[model samples]
Target: MSLRVLALLVLLSIQNLFAQQLSPEASIRVLTIGPGYNLNDAFGHSAFHIQDHSQNIDMVFNYGVYDFDTPNFYTKFAQGKLHYLIGVNYFDDFMLMYKRQNRTVQSQELDLDTGQKQALFDYLLENYKPENRRYLYDFFYNNCATKIRDVLQTAVGEPIVFHEPEAFQPQTFRTLIQDNLKTNSWGSMGIDLALGSVIDQTATAEEHMFLPEYIHTFFSSATLGNSNKKLVKQDKTLYTKQAINSNKSSFFTSPIFVLGVIGLFIVIITYFDFIKGKRSRWLDFTISVLTGVIGLLLLLLWFATDHTATAQNYNLLWAFPLNIILGIQLLKKQPKPWVIKFLKFLFIMLALMAFHWSVGIQVFAPVLIPLLLALVIRYMYLVYYLKNEKL
Candidate 1:
């Protein structure tokens, strides 16, 4: 062979050898971040940490990143069609952001062999490349937590046997979510109202890994494929929250208290009208319009969105879209003949909602109890008034 060919072969061999060499000081860890004070961060977050002392590299690979500048950002996000990308950030920068938020951060060092560690690191580097990074985000099936689980299993080229956490009990997705939410908070109520029957079904043990906390818990005892060897070599807290009273929220401002006050107002107006044998068109109109608009939103979530949890919602029974038409009719001194029939239909729909609640078909927001009761009374009176009022 020519000297040029020999030199080229030598350079190729050198590159290959360098690529295969992962420094003994290199470490691979999974970082689990605790919840923040926002709906989006309520469930927590997960990311991979890669540090090599010899290479002067310490970076975090985050799968939960999305570009806000993407075309039709809000629309695509609402429809669940937005792309989430893997992002590389310096370890200090990443930890600083979380610390500033006062969120707890925990790190788990993985028990990966040198070859496995390099394979995983190389895979993450490739995934961080612009064209290779973006992936379709799914709440339950795929997300940051599941990404870590999948990457570790793939890197090790072995099945990871995730032992169930000691505190884990079988639970529905909604219940699992509720564990993080304050019972009477708007976030909890909004989730219950927006989501549907599908979330009520019991989630399997493996399915619970969709949440970051569960991912951390299960991986604590996870073993390498058919071996007694553990997946995590060591676990330690990267950051712990300092006691800060300023970050606290008050229960008086919560959804339950606010909704209860509104329910009381509705009941007073409704009761006074029933006793006086006179209907308050404005109050009735407000109820219909409010429920109707919410119903329309729920309909869009169920049909137009790619969110699986929003399907087959039973909240529609109470917040019917027809309430808008009925509300418009309530504006007339003498409504059309169909008005009474529609009122009756609404009352029956409320009954069906009660059945669903009792049978555990769909669990609604507990904060809605007073409002629901008031609606039932108002709806009943509307049916009676429309039938008995002089035409």
Candidate 2:
């Protein structure tokens, strides 16, 4: 066959195989984010106010800082409005809206990625003086923020009020982008692109205040989020040829996740040991067990997360320490024989899964898999031997 004929056949085959994946529309969804009544919303207070008029929104997601002394809102806005997001909903909505109409986030192409953000910030600190930071601020505001409002207005056919950066001063979009903006580094230009993404209507930004009451609100209101309620479709099939061969590691390459499983087993053991009169101080033992559970949750999050923005999720890296603590507690328990035997079986299974996953990582897999197996086996045997000897 001629090359053109061959190309046509390949295209048809691919189309027939997948039939164009489409997110089934549900009520023309528009996501809105708003501020918590409190200060903790990670974005800014001004954003929350804009989000309050949620008449057009299909889903409203609120974000707030964790209970740490530094709140998430106080974190610098990504040149104002953009955030590091990698979730299915964001992806689905973006793809859908673009297909529904020729909606674009940029007037000109803006490759908004992590490298772009770093390059832009670096340029500012290098070339611009502290007192002359107006150049930096002006470029971000007019080129990034105003262009954003203009783009959304074109799509929604309504004048949308975007959450301008705290540093924002109202100026003509043309003046900002064409005149002052050109003088700054090309990196600064990208910052405008990224910030433009964050506050755009399809992917709005808000301040989420995560209060203890927010959890309580969900529990108290039958209409709200239920932890027990399941999203069954979220479960993905494992061990496919692609899944097996892809460089991305699933449950196996996730060290924190694997440790979470180990911690859970330890907690179960500790509870049983207390029941068997082998240990006391239930609360302390319970804490030891819970550490594993929490670490495991962190592990799953790490795996599910967008690794391209590792810095955003860096807090979860500390989950490793908790996993270690859980291991120590398990070893201290001096397990009963049945418990040791069961753990030995689990260790073998976990090791096999790790090995399967490591196939993708090649040599790195070999080192990580064996080390994990040794840790599980070593701790289990130590507990078993101590228990039998009553030491």
Q: RMSD to native for every prediction?
A: 7.1, 22.7
lDDT scores of the candidates, listed in order: 0.86, 0.31
**In model 2, what is the error at residue 200, expressed in angstroms?**
29
**Runs in model 2 lying further than 4 Å from the true structure:** 1-71, 74-294, 297-334, 358-370, 376-380, 383-391
lDDT of model 1, residue 218: 90
Q: Give the RMSD in angstroms, all C-alphas superposed, for model 1.
A: 7.1
Tens digit per residue, CA lDDT, model 2, 1-391 = 5746754654443334232222222112122222221222211111000111132222211122121232352342322222321111122343343334322211111112233223322332222232422221122232222222232234332233223344434332222222222222232223222122122112112111111211111212212122332111121211111112324335453544554566565556655754574543343335335435644554543454332211122222222325444444555545345555444554554555455344521111122333344346444544555465564
Model 1: which residue pairs collide? none
lDDT of 1 by residue, 64-159 (tens): 787787899999988988888887666887899899999999999999888888888888876766678889888888899989988888877888
lDDT of 1 at 5: 76
What TM-score would each prediction reach against the true structure? 0.91, 0.23
